[model samples]
Target chain A: MSYFSDIYKGIKTLLTGMSVTGKYFLTSRKGAITQQYPDNRATLKMFDRFRGEVIMPHNENNEHRCTGCQKCEIICPNGTIEIIWDRGIDEETGKKKKKIDQFVYHLSMCTMCALCIDVCPTDAIIWGQNFENSVYDRTKLTRVLNEPESKLMPGVED
Target chain B: MALREKNNKPNSLKTNNLELGTQNMKPETINSNFKSEEYQINMGPQHPATHGVLNLLLTIDGETIKKVEPDLGYIHRSIEKMCERDSYQQIVHLTDRMDYLSSNINNEAVCLAVENALELEIPERVKVIRTIIGELTRISSHCLWWGVMGMDVGALSTFFYGFRDREMLNDIFEETCGARLTMNYNVPGGLMLDIHPNFVKRVKKFVTHFKTKIPEYDRLLTENVIFQKRTKGVGVLSKEDAISFGVSGPVARASGYSCDVRKYHPYSALDKVTFNESLKTEGDTFARYQVRIQELWESLSIVEQLIDNIPEGEYRVKTNAVIKLPKGEFFQKVETARGEFCVYIISTGTKSPYRLKFRSPGFSNLSVLNHIAVGGKIGDLVAILATLDLVIPDIDR
Candidate 1:
């Protein structure tokens, strides 16, 4: 009867499925794809595009491209960037101009969107490939991107 | 005296009710026995089988589900309200949280909406790359679902196999976009960046690798008698019911609905690619499973077409710093891994949208749960839910 044929077909199909799994099971240790995370930490490497944290690159002379335009601050969906700038005398032109006092970034609020980096006119900020960003305290995640004594790079003001 | 009688009317009605209750109780008092009641159970805002923070209020009579009421809003973040406050550019990132498995497609839907409003001409390269990545996203989403579906049906190894392949795709996404799960790579104009140098090579290798692995997938679960017994002819959603419930994606296709957004409304490089939209007439849990499986092959074919032929041009168009849509209504729909994901934006000539609505596929697919699962056994409900492949955040949002 058709009923018996159906029953026979079901068993055949099940065995087919089991055979596939069985092949993998027999393959065993060599087929294992899992990376022993912490144990393999020494060999792990992150990609160049990984959006870990916003960092401001500085030259050997400690001059940076950041002119404190506050573009990043405005473009940020969340209030993740706080640009506190004050008017200071320009060294080359001997004229008053806006200079960055602090380029504050909150890691906790950052979505790793890289939107701020994309919109930055001066190419001052970049995503640093440091994925381990966990912190014990919330305040510890906030940081001033520029060095303590870094100044705006010459010709960036224009 | 009239007012007093009106007030006493309530007392007399209460006395009549008490007399009737005593009369009914007299029969019960003579024949004292316990009666069984339908059992109620809360599946979860925390249950693993729920796939996310989804609560199913199930009324069961001895393991058969009498009713299913989905309790939503556990993961609701008011994303639409948030969109009203955020600029069009910033809104792209928020969509990544909904139907996170198909984040790329979600991002593309929003981007397409804004681009259509502006009448922007996206470069050919952008179109090709977008199509490639979109197919990749579909394959990855299906891979994850296939594994999860297997697990849901009591075959656990499929989970590992599915994730193993999925990790490859995630690596490819991470290499190019920087984020693995919530890849906010699509801007209004085009992609956030060009594909990674190894993107093409890696994708080619993945295609070859996955092609061979699909048979293993079949062997491990698809043909399994136990899986078939559990799934076949269970939770059948007829074409009429499917359409009435507004179910889309594989769920609709399984019921023989030719409603593939990519097929009907070709966007990006979808028109360029040659692929079949997987369809079935059964409309059961197994049919839904087969539809997604067939779609995986089709998605791979779509990617293979565009991956090599990615035109060389600018990755993104130079849009203005502040993107303001014209004061009008704009709508765009894209075929996500699940189904039709639509973004409707009402602009008041401002940087931010006046109102935004995301017509997510999971919401409609989820609506059919009660319709299909009510008469099924409690165990069969899990298989039905698995086939539905609901992403609760998309529903809640």
Candidate 2:
């Protein structure tokens, strides 16, 4: 620990630290990995594995696969959900069945835990990668999935 | 005289060094206390080095600090109030937003608290997985601290290098839980999802890659003479003082206090694992640096040991499809990178908690400022504050 050695160590240490900055500043050649998010969503890829918002899918007859079973409602920990059933008459089958009437969810209240997707037995509801979920008003967050009612039970394989 | 300069100028808070200068006081200030002529200075309401809006009033004369007064409640978001408004499962997300840097731990803490309240039994496999992820969060948090602490002393390059490996940790986190900063991955009783297939392999790579880089970190920042000179004996809080002030984590360990929640009170699967707690006898700024630098290796070793041993089972416990907890008060204390965090929940036998309160580590860490920063040089103030690694939101909460 001589004085001269200490000076040299300080200079050497400084150079070593600067080199890290130099390395990063010079290495902008590294690939452009950032997706530029919302600006380029039309061109960018979205993985199915991406944990996005939850959505209920529909069958070929435009009938929602959500059976008013409340499986998703049960699995959701936040209770950012409310499900209502409506009695609907099937045109072909000519019988009344419980159908999903209102599927309400609050995005602001959502933690995106993804439990609702896992609990849905029919795979009727899936997590969608529409990540541009920012909204100005909390009221707009409460949503109902509007699927057509005409094609309900025209034909069924189940 | 420094007293003349203080009398001539009024306080405006536009200095790299935050100080509260000499002021008149009665001769006898305490009965048993030997510390003399302590002046107080507040560091924040808007100080960048305080890390997030902490207010500290420091007492000083010349270059040695005598008293540091920390005033908090700037960034508090009423997070617990919002939590009680949501259901048991909903509180998990709230935890993520509270401690943005250690979001995983936040998620895990809230979830663990909920499970404790509900008497929910988590699978053994879930506990082990929680332990591994929790340690990874610790590594990332420490890495960021090292870099910023260096920058606080005007060494900017360490900041970038710290983020270099930290970026890898974030990527690993991103792949597992989607969001980078606020990943609410842990839920009550278990994780939100099963561990991804490549998780073990990615972790194995990090263990080898990060171990090699430790020497590089030492060479880059820790070994420097200037750093050692700037930190040694500055802001030295003795073990007795640390315990009185309730300082935990590296701050308390640096002072020889047995305060790490991980070692004394193990949560998750930390009890099953063996890891050394890094300690220093000096209780100075320099000692805190050493404690953190030494702990990196220990944390990495824990990750290495647990990566292969993760049990095969459901990631989270299978609860009543929707979770509802019995009415009672539940309290949980888990180790954050900075110190011990206490999460308190009061339930009225409802879907949501009746009330929630988070006893964040930064509150206690920030509280000790007034005692340490008096009579110290302007240069050492940043160093002492950096050692505490204060996060603003936690303080406000």
Most accurate candidate by TM-score: 1
Which DockQ value does candidate 2 get? 0.32
Every candidate's DockQ is: 0.63, 0.32
Q: What share of the true interface contacts does candidate 1 keep?
A: 0.82
* Model 2: per-residue Cα lDDT over B333-370, one tens digit each: 99888888888888788777788888888778877876
TM-score of 1: 0.92
The sequence of per-residue lDDT tens digits that candidate 1 reaches over residues B73-153 is 998999999999999899999999999999999999999999999999999999988888888999999999999999888
Q: Pick the candidate with the highest lDDT.
A: 1
lDDT tens readout by residue for model 1, A1-158: 97898789877887777777787788878757788988988998889898888999999999999998899999899899999999999887899999999999999999877889989989999989888888789899999998998999989952
**Can you tell me which runs of candidate 1 are displaced by over 4 Å?**
A1-15, A29-31, B1-35
